[model samples]
Target: MTLRRLPDLTWEDVGALDLDRTVAILPVGATEAHGPHLPLDTDVTIAAAMAEAGGRRLSAHGLEAVLLDALQYTPAAFAASFPGTISIGGATLAALLTDLAASVQRAGIPTLAIANAHFDPTHLRALHTAVSAINAGGVLRAVFPDVTRRPWGGRLTAEFRSGACHAGQYEGSIVLARSPERVRGEVMRELDDNPVSLSAAIAEGAQDFVAAGGPQAYFGSPAAATAEEGHATIETLGDILSEAVIDALGTETWPRTKEQT
Candidate 1:
């Protein structure tokens, strides 16, 4: 069966689905500079890829899931100094998520899974608040956050943990794997020596990294990235997210009871 995409799904199409077995997957990503090798929309691109992969996997099992257009360009305060880094601030991001959740709920989707690739603390917090509010009001039946923490997250590991987690070998490899035509090999070579250690920088909260502080805006060694690793990461994430969707949908309940006032 062909899976439905959010942008292409019509009201009639939505009405035909088994509501209990369907999930709405929202791909949330950031538009920031990913060094020299990857595109500015690396986070958004990866999130979309993950969502699509997960949706396909779920669809094969008689469970339906659709990938929503990624909410690209999140609040990246730490990387704001870098060129091509576009942010909307914490308040705006929170409001956007809330509105999106509200719309999904109003459309009768019982479960909403936010597949986010960007690991900004503020964005995560905003997502949590938005999802919590929607679920608490009984508008959304359930919400799943940080789908990456699942077992499938392990597949992203490589010689460089920074690459797998941020704009490094992992992301560059995935981009090359999924969309090789877009990878800029020349730029990757030019910025090969300016890789940043995301964990250390964030832990220290210091603005003294070579990428963010110096010439480049990347945090990992894209030189180590390969198309093979990217494919494996995508496949693993797909499996994890598919299972998550099934579990989430199964746990969904209806007829919310009113609290005693």
Candidate 2:
């Protein structure tokens, strides 16, 4: 079996898949503020690439998986103040995911896997809530490895924990890894480091980017980001993603057997 992209494949191609063993990966992202240097689709790019890597990992592990289109509009409460940052309401985001999950199940896909990159509190809550709703409906819930947790989180870079990684070294590095041209060299060189803990500010009732002490809508060492570190970060993210798929496959509830009454 090949690692296919759901959108690129024809209906006949999808029909040929072994539904019992196949899984659909749904990459989720938010078109939010990513500081001055990064684009609006930064989250989307990261999530989509990670999802593809995860799909490849599942294929390597002897299962079939495909990457689906990413959900771009997610809750962006923090970045919503910034111009060009588009955000959907939390409830709306949840409604969309719930509908997508149901749509996938009806297509005969055995299971739906969610791949995400955005770390906004509201965004995370919406994704989980949507998944919970789907799971409650008796549909096979997707595997969402909390990258913010141990093991996987530990696998990520140090800047991630500092909470100043928004468009900083952590994100900048991986963005460079994925697309070097997108990174502005002059901006990176001139930008001073802001090592403030965004989490701390948020704990103190900081809501938006400015309230978080980031007037420029950024934090951490953007200038220090290197392509080498970016590649390494991408690799680690891929490991986290693929591992989730493998682990989820072991516990899939697809082709659910009828309970013996």
Candidate 3:
């Protein structure tokens, strides 16, 4: 009865849940280098945590949250130089997402909510393409809050707004909050705040992190990241996901009688 992850559940386990109130929560991120101090699955970890928190929020509203397997392979052209970074072509990523969306539709899930932590330009484009393709099929639709935009973006940390948060304090802090043991504190202490905006560099035709003035594959102040901030950021991210999904589903108030699990 405590099951939240779809991949961990049997067919009958899912069937026992109220089908009408179930929502699929897909955590999307890239398998790429975060920095010397952070882990390669940093983005994936953040996405999964955010989605899980959103799932809990949904549960509080009397809905069943079905957590989908996190998609870790995403388009990471910019971080290609890192040893641990693995990236797929944008088209390949797009097709994969499109197929998944279609499968969700065929399975009778009217809506799929994606909680993405990686916001690579190519990845965003691919997601947009997949959403378009799925909507065109008229079966189901994929909704991504795209926290990079407006109001939601503003709600995040200032480092995120700077757009050079690759493995910096913003990211490192989140990892610290989730799993402090994984962080290499020595390396993190050695790294300082990289003020260069990788976003701006990319706009100026820099295709990779080195060209973006992040030669070490990191930006922003890793030394400044704290677990407190990391937890706060996760909470903010969860709010973004919850609001986006709720708005997309057209839920005006609490969907049903509150159900605690």
Best prediction by TM-score: 3
Give the distance in Å from residue 204's predicted Cα in candidate 1 to where it truly belongs: 1.9
lDDT of 1 by residue, 1-261 (tens): 456787897888888878766788888888877766678888888888888888887667666687777889787765677787888878788787778877877777777877778876677777777777777886575455464344444445643444324666778878888888888887775655444556566566654335334346666676777889888878866766766666655533322124211
Which ten contiguous residues of candidate 3 have the minimum total lDDT?
Answer: 252-261
Clashes of each: 0, 0, 0
lDDT of 3 by residue, 1-261 (tens): 232898888978877777666788899998898878888899999999899888887776766788999999999998998898999988998899888887776666777889999978999888888878877887685778888777788998989899878899888999999999999999899887799988788778998898888888898999898999999999888878877877777765455533421
How much lDDT does candidate 1 score?
Answer: 0.70
* lDDT assessment of candidate 2: 0.80
Largest lDDT belongs to which candidate? Answer: 3
Rank the candidate models, highest TM-score first.
Answer: 3, 2, 1
Q: Each candidate's TM vs. the true structure?
A: 0.85, 0.92, 0.94
TM-score-wise, the better of 1 and 3 is 3
lDDT tens string, model 2, 4-58? 8888999988888887778898888888777788878888878877887777766
What is the overall TM-score of model 3 with all chains considered together? 0.94
Give candidate 3's error at residue 134 in angstroms.
1.6
Query: How much is 184 displaced in model 2, in angstroms?
Result: 1.5
